[model samples]
Target chain A: MDAIAEKKPVAFNRWLPYWAVFQADVRQTLRSWVYLFWVLLSVLATVGYLLYRFGSYHEGGIVQTASVHVSQLLRWIVLGSAAIVCVLTAGSITSERGTMADSVLSRGISRYQYFLGKWHARLATVLGTFLTLGIATLISALFLLHEDLSLDGSLVALAVVAALLTTVITFGVTVSAVANSTVLGIAVLWSMLCAAGFLMSFLPPRYPSPDRTLERLPYILQGNYDLAGLAQFAGWSLLASGVAALFGLGYFSRRDV
Target chain B: MAENSSSNMVVETFKLTKIYQNRQIALNDVTLRLEPGCVLGLLGSNGAGKTTLLRLIIGLHRPTAGWAKVFGKFMTPNAAELRRRIGYIPTNPQFPRGMTPITYLDYMARLFGLPKDVRKPRLASLIRAVDLLRVSGDSIAGFSNGMTARLAVAASLINEPDLLIWDEPTHGLDPEARRSMLELIKTLSREKTLIVSSHNLSDIDEVCNHAAVLSHGQLIYCGSLQDLKGRMRRNHFELDLEGEQKAITKSTTAIRALPEFKVVTLKHRRLELYLQEEVGGAAALANVLMTLNDNKVTLVSIRSVGQQTEQAFLDLVEKEESRGFARIYQAEAA
Candidate 1:
């Protein structure tokens, strides 16, 4: 078969949008029974807890203890299962690779664009899930804790912090892609998070009152509520989440398929 | 490259090489050029590096050396644009399970940013082209392997990619389905460059104008099918005669006679002959006919070789094996 002329590269263009990719990823994620189960169960649990602890209505007699406690518990829940998002992203790539999806690579797009497109779609999914849980937790806390728990400026700062912390989700996704197994990826993500938490505790100049840290958490959850810690949270979140996203971006950029 | 400026070559790999982490060489300094509006058959046995070569071309995996470009740009530059220009169909395509072609195709179409107006017509056309219109709305869980293959093919075309790469596109199809898929590939090649990998020689013998045979990650041969057929050094011919023994002894020793045939049973009738490379096959046939005429032997029939070209191909594979490559000739035996 030697009659053909030498080969040359074909010109390609990138006209697709990030939103479309994100929409496709989310649709696929929603179709998963596991994700549906998590969404339904998380919502139900939040609803049941609110109903059992306090009636459907919020009254002035509520205490800050339960609100703060619930906020902390929800954060833990969100972070704990966040590894699943990574697993999902990683699984998508691995399964395609296993079946030799390189067929897709013959397309015009470069590896960088493919990886970014996928990363963008996956990140959007993580953000969407985070929002859903946030709404549920917010509604539950508002009902159980009532107006007795004031929404302070500190609360606004905390909300920002939560959003920033959630950037950790990107790290999980990246780890999932490079690591061999979903379990190992999740472990890597968890270990990294635990390490971060431990490092945060060791930071010199601990807050004057250790117990007050619990009381201060809800303010931190409320994003921009506390101007005092605003810079710290923003600085840390940007640096940490940005670095995390880069890790994923870097891993994905170099990966085949 | 210049003559077809507007009709640009879609997929191109220049001296591409892929060395697996375990040190297995998947492709060795492959330099291939696929022009627009043509179909190329990657004919090889399993583990012949067909898939590996495909992966490198598509940028699914990094090459150990050299580079590949799709739609005229290196894979790392403007990747999204590159993706927009090519379609890929892998054998045994997997879905997220329970996903219907409609959803999946729609998702892919959207990913390509095909507007609602464009997506509707494009999706409908692709589904019809692949003959999956009836089940486009059905879940993949219930689809057969052939159906999935069709869907994968259809999805790859959603963007009307200029280059299409399909690995074993008809691997598990029924004969009818295989024919339809091959025909579809032929139709696609009218406007797009298509590369298909498969071990079905007969299937390829029909659709492929250009082909390359891979053995142990190295291309043993690459060219047009006609050129390959033309490269054979010998032409075969069979002769039937009465008093075969007398004719066999009388014929010149320059021509090799088959000793395998039973002369006693034929009494006087038997088959025998050969055509050397320098002797025009037709001239050799004339000589044999003359010899038969002189010996008063009646001619039964004369025809060109029935399947010597195929046998010659097997012989080439054996030759390659003897030179150091592991032979997968058992696939032909199957």
Candidate 2:
């Protein structure tokens, strides 16, 4: 046999791994058993909650307001999916921990690209689910239930809940990247969620946190909320997510695969 | 540090150390330089840090105290371009679940940024090469250990890396799969710089010209295979004879009377012996043939069977362990 010639790395395009990661992770997230269960459960809960609202209003001889409709739509769909979302995002890093070493460590793939790809894929899932459920519930409340829910109120409520969901997903992914085990990541995320809620309750309502923003989501949707407080909360929440994202990226880059 | 980047060197580690979780000193102060072309056999017992060292060189695990350079650049976790030149087969590879070989290889090729045109043909060729053509469309979850290992081999070569670092490539393979893998390594050794870490010293003896033996996280021996064998002061021999049992029994006495020979065992015209340092088995075997002068006795096949590299490795590890005990003894005494 002739001597094997020495080889060089391919003149690789930098963005390939990032895009591949995003595409593969999107498939993985959508096909996961938990995600399938989540979709089914979310649809059932939203439909049930809508029917119950109509039944309650009819029985009490009271009209369902726009704020009530929007609030409960979120309560049933977004908040209901939060635990399953946490599970999906928390295992995002830990689940890949063993397999990724074979591919990511052996190639020209950046941790930044990998981290962002996974982050963006799960982020897409959260936003996509929220929008789909929000639109469906809005139509149901408007036509079928004859509830007085406004388009502006529904959109505003969906956007705020979307931002808050983004924060939760980002935090969950970061915790997964930082912790060594999926169990640990899930525990830390649940703790952070609880801590955020508990800590925000201690703060005055004028400068509301994201957790506080959710509590008064109805008032916020009705435009009775303080605009200055909403902006501050949005900025702080984004800054926190940004910091966590940077930390998770840096930590993951140095972590042993 | 300058010599590490000297183009001819494929891998270099200077005082490279790794202490995992502040408790296990997985690899300690291992310094070596591997030139291009030599297939280095990494021989170490379980937990001797073979995996740790390989991981360090590939930039999967960072060095705690020193550094490693692969292809002239310091290997870091984020050294994407440098890492692109390395093909690593991790121990018991856990491939992405729910993916067929075709999809997995496609994913791997894309990670290395191969274009659709280049990626398709390459995956096809590699699948054929590793004999995974039949299962190319099957999910990796259904693959046996042998199949998964073959897929991993294909994945490693996706980018045509300059250096191949394989950790226990045949750890769980059946004999057939193991033999095929060894044959593949032998073929690949003609061209690429490979570091194969395995406990199968016989396989190492077959394919590797250079050997590195690690004992308890320390480099006990590192040099050419000939040099490692040269350190052995005793020689081993095995022989088969075509003769009557009576003739063979009589010849054994004459063989034992020879000054240089020590008969280890003799049974049914077969013989095993060891010789003292220097004369080795060849000269001693000649003397034995001269002494077995019975016309009824004849040599069928005579092989100056040398001590396998396995023996050398065991001797090396045994010696290192004793020294370790000695040092601890002294420390306790102090």
Candidate 3:
């Protein structure tokens, strides 16, 4: 037989690796009966809490302030989302090393591809889970409060919250990639976020006595809530997320093991 | 397209040297080449840079100096195209814990961009090829080491790469599984160039078309396996004779009178001697042997001394270690 020269087709774009990783991540995270159970149970608990609080206020013949209840519901949603995102991000990359899937690095899969695939999978998972849970919480809050939330002056507030969530997602991923184990990644990420919160609280009081500039931080003590203040918070979150992405991409690209 | 054997240098490393900060040199100025469709073995003991060289070839780590290329492409992870053309199997591969082989392979196949139509059949075929058909749907948690290795081999082939690099591929396998794995490797060699790094010489001897011995990050020997065997052959012959000691001594002395018999030992009725290759004095020694025969001496046996290649390997390693990398590289180049 005559020898034939051939180019084995490499049709998948570089992004294809990300898709592969995404599938693996989804299968790993969601296929576990425990996680599925957790998702359902957590959403139900949020709904029940919303109903109980509203029902209690109505029976007591007390008019619960709309602002207080709305803030409380948002707080619960943010806190719940934070915990889920942390759990999801903690295992994305570090756990892969524990599992030997890092062999993909040795097997002609670029570390960059491996990392991106993980990031995409993780981004999809955390964001997808967050959206699901966030919507469930929002719906429960809306039914109880009987208020229509609109995107008016709240645009900047929305941006700040989005940015904060992005920062958390990227920061958690960076930690996961660098950490030796999943538990260690989780510990480091949460510890750092907690430290950031504590440090922010200790910042010196604003120089302008009557108009305290330190009131601008999101979820901070002492502030006349406004979009401009939220804008500044959004700026910090964006900066943090961008810096995290750079670190994650750079380190994952060059790591040898 | 017609095959171009001249251009198919599947793996080429030129003056590759890697020195870690810990003062250990993993690879030292190692220049090598592998032709497409050739199965080459990188043989070495522990800490011998076998894994290091494979890592460089796969572009997992950058070379400290010189260059390495796989499938004729430069050694860089950015050469994603080249990675697609090459498959790597680590000594032990780690798959996602709960997923079955089929799910993992299917996912990888899709990532490699095999259409679902193409992926399903190909995945099924590979799973069966590795004798993992029975457990394709089962989680990898319970698989034996050999089964895991077989699954790894199958996964590496998902992209149908033209080059396959295996680092100690048969590391932990039962004898039967090891044999099957080796045979599978041989079968794969027909369609792709392969680089197998192993400390097991028997594995290299069984399947490798060419072999290189690595010790302390230096390539001490590189060539055909037959050439390696030939190099270690003894340059002497033993002759067994049943006779009086005096007659054997007389005959030995007569032979020693010639320049070819460098050393002679008389042990019982056996006389072993070192002889120069292509010696002209064999005829003279035959004449003396004839005289001993006439005097009623019985020539019991005559055979070449047996020297194992494994012994020569040990000697090579010792010699390389004593002189160290500096001398080993010089000798290798020479």
The interface RMSD values of the models, given in order, are 4.7, 1.7, 2.7
Over 4 Å off, model 1:
A1-17, A55-66, A79-126, A145-147, A153-161, A206-215, A218-226, B1-11, B233-297, B302-309, B324-334
Model 3 chain B worst lDDT run, 10 consecutive residues: B1-10
Q: Over 4 Å off in model 3, which ranges? A: A1-10, A31-55, A65-70, A76-84, A106-109, A145-159, A179-184, A202-225, A228-232, B1-8, B20-24, B233-309, B324-333
Q: In candidate 3, residue A18 scores what lDDT?
A: 61
- Per-candidate Cα lDDT values, in order, are 0.63, 0.81, 0.70
Candidate 2 residues B1-334, lDDT tens each? Answer: 1243456688988888999899999998888889888899999989999999998998878899898988878988888778777788988888777899899989988887787877889899999999999888888998899998999999889877779999889989999999999999998888899999998888899889999988878887889988888776556667788767878888887777777865457977788887865575667767777766553687778665645687788778876777755744432342
Model 1 local distance difference test score:
0.63
Native contacts kept, each candidate: 0.58, 0.66, 0.45
TM-score of each: 0.79, 0.90, 0.79
**Residues B216-317 of candidate 3: C-alpha lDDT, one tens digit per residue:** 898888777777776663546678898777777777766676566678777788877776666654564676477568666778888766544565566678
Residue lDDT tens for model 1, B151-176? 88888888877778888888889998
How many times do residue backbones clash in model 2?
1
Error of 3 at B173 (Å): 1.9
Kindly indicate the candidate among 2 and 3 with the higher DockQ: 2
**Cα RMSDs of all predictions?**
7.1, 4.1, 5.8
Per-residue lDDT value at A49 in model 2: 73
